[model samples]
Target: MKKRNQYSAEFKAKVVLEVLREEATVNEIASKYGIHPVMVNRWKQEFVDRASEVFKKGPSEAEKALEKEQQHVAELERKVGQLTYEVDWLKKKSDEILNRKRP
Candidate 1:
């Protein structure tokens, strides 16, 4: 039994690009590359799906994590500020009530 041939990414991309450009039919490309038409179609689909990612300027994984952490810190700070305000209000109310009773 012979092992199946493994095509490189560059080679697959070239064939897929040719298919995208409509320079040749899927059957023609497969015949030229000696691969099955289904394989060519699959590569073309994958290439098209990831075409947008090639131009995406989104941050890396670490940057995304840092942004998320920063957001969490901001949320915690806001909650702390709210709690502090509530505590101060309660303390002032208690003091006013006590003063009225004493006077």
Candidate 2:
């Protein structure tokens, strides 16, 4: 089977921009660019949707803080498991010692 052609991000962006400019229809743009019309339309819509947020800043500080809190919680859960195991081991040892002395 022959491998399909892969279009780069730059090429997709260019084609989407062209479609947005109204210089050509989606079908015409796809045929001229050797890409599928459906793919071209999808990219065009994505570009239009994200155009407003393109200039916006990255994730907010609250998002970053939540990520940090998640990491801390994972670490604490791991430590709790280790401590639980150690406590179980110590309890078994104490029970064995007490049973030996009960005679």
Q: How far is candidate 1 from the true structure (C-alpha RMSD, Å)?
A: 10.6
Candidate 2: segments with Cα more than 4 A from true spot:
59-103
Q: Write the per-residue lDDT of candidate 2 for residues 41-90, one digit (tens) a residue.
A: 88888888878766779876677899999999999999999999999999
| Leading candidate by lDDT | 1
Model 1 C-alpha lDDT versus the unseen true structure: 0.92
What stretches of model 1 exceed 4 Å from their correct place? Answer: 59-103
| Winning candidate number (TM-score) | 1
Number of backbone clashes in candidate 1: 0
Tens-place lDDT digits, model 1, residues 22-62: 98899998999899999998998898887887777988667
Please provide the root mean square deviation of candidate 2 (C-alpha atoms, Å): 5.6
Q: List TM-scores for all candidates, in order.
A: 0.54, 0.52
